[model samples]
Target: MSKRDYYEVLGVSRTASDEELKKAYRRCAMKHHPDRNAGDATSEAAFKECKEAYEVLSDASKRRMYDQHGHAAFEHGMGGGAGGGAGYADMGDIFGDMFGNIFGGGGRGPRRGADIGYVMELSLEEAVRGVEKQIEIPTLDECDSCDGSGSADGKLETCGTCNGRGQVRFQRGIFSMQQGCPHCGGRGQTIENPCGKCHGQGRVEDTKSLQVKIPAGVDNGDRIRLTGEGEAGPAGSPPGDLYVEVRVREHEIFQREGDDLHCEVPIRLTQAALGAAIRVPTLGGEVELKIPAETQAGKVFRLRDKGVQSVRSRRPGDLYCRVVMETPVNLTSEQRELLQQLEATFTGEDARRHSPRSSTFMDGVKGFWDRMTSS
Candidate 1:
């Protein structure tokens, strides 16, 4: 009998991606699996046919040949056999790939340790300027007592269940699923006598102390990866990485926005009316800000190159200082009398000329009252 097209057999299109082909093959093969449809010859034949289709399509070379020439590409035995493509002959390995990532067991060897994340808090000054800090973190470390072997007399026996393979296969419905051996815990060996310190785990809880260098201009939420500094792997495998995430505490003097900094500069009422050069606080230090004559409240003054310079962008930003007029408080009788005398000097059109905003507001109030009475 002539064979059906591989794409048709697996119920997938020729342009299907490798992942799509695998999903299609998995569905078709499992539906017609011999184990599921026992004593059904049609289902068994369908299963074998789908498996053959998957084997050919899964191999890049075989897939290219099959795509160009169709079934006639392999008219005789095969250009390449079971070794070239995981055909129906190797059900063990084929099913292992299909079910591995889904169930977490495959031909790939042991896994490494889990990565760890540590949040490091820093002040605004420390973040802008680089600093080195010594940090201590609690994690699993290789047991010095057992040399990470978990065996007490430096002796281990092959696991009876997995037969030194570290994985065991079991029939799950129509599929054969594999997982790490319970007896060996994926180590392929069992301890004759467990270590007293780590018990048979090959690792123990320990504190790791190291000096970490935080680069300058690192903002909040930035992370620094410390390679191979994470928890020790299970059974002496390669360790993982440690990530240090930076958290910048709020500053009292300045508010940082991207590279620029903003701060409030308070000046006396007399200084706002007349002119005065007042000192303002910055991240670096205090700087002199010249207030122009008759400078209004909330007037912003830009200081060039006075803000933070980020690590990524080397260009420094400007500092914006908003002038806040300070009202005199708790004045003595003489001071109150002097303020009253100053207030008396301004009258009528002269007061209007001095405070245009206040004159515009009174005019608006008059207009509003006129409109209300008319309505």
Candidate 2:
């Protein structure tokens, strides 16, 4: 059987970032983990599929090659020697080490903290114009008391239980297995005197105030990355990054589609009959738009360089204005009489010339009725 698409296996888009890919992989691995679904071959196969997809997509070179060549890049020696092999001999141990945190297992290593995401809501104006915003994020930071050492004296000793290995061996019937040390929690070390502030965790939960600079022309779903602004790592390890996602609120007057902006402008019936110049709202300011004489309703006018400027290209887009003629309402008796007298002028054959679209539509309807009766 053929392998599934890597992105499909991980349930992510091709444009997914490293953080998104990691999150998706974690979700899949957690759901399909072998230990979670014991004796289920389907679940085991699914877990392996996710793992293989993650391994290829997580690597920069491998991902690029795969993108260019598809699955062929990883087969027939294209992925290079030994890469094509499905090495699942020690899958259990490998997965246990990778996802120990989720399963309450432990391992010894300088693990980077998990990345975080924040949604930033913006008005249409704010999205068009660059703005700096202050935001608060709650996460774990290095404990000040022990300076992230986890010890009151800033010293740690090798764990006697795991013998500095961070794992202990135990016999289960016919097989022997290695598991994290219960005493050390897989750190392979022990804090003789835990820090009073953070116990032995080496981190403290706190809310951090940060200023994020948003660029102009950012659309919904655009992300801005802030390096090292995520949760602090354990034992002074490297911290992760923060992703600020943008969501633009719906505008009352205008609707945005890509770089273009569209709006409906209501024009008076007199203005539609006689050419007139009217003011319309644009992102920058109000601009004059001229309507030609006898302009029909729903006529679209394009105003160049009146829309949003693209963030990537720095090129301004056009604004499309669709005109709808508004009928006169609440007229005085004298005004109504004058309008009625004016309407009498086009009562005969002149009405066809005055209302050509209505005349053509009526003609089509008559033709349809004649054909239906004849048939």
Candidate 2: residue 95 lDDT (0-100): 58
Q: Model 2: per-residue lDDT, tens digit, 40-119?
A: 89998998789779767875545765797777654522221222223432544555566445433353444566688999
Task: Mark the regions of model 1 whose C-alpha exceeds 4 Å error after superposition.
Answer: 1-89, 330-337, 369-375
Expressed as tens digits, the lDDT of each residue in 47-126 for candidate 1 is 87886787678755457657977876544212222122333335656787876766565543445665778999999999
Q: How many residue pairs clash in each candidate?
A: 0, 0
CA lDDT, every prediction? 0.78, 0.79
Worst 10 residues of 2 by lDDT: 76-85
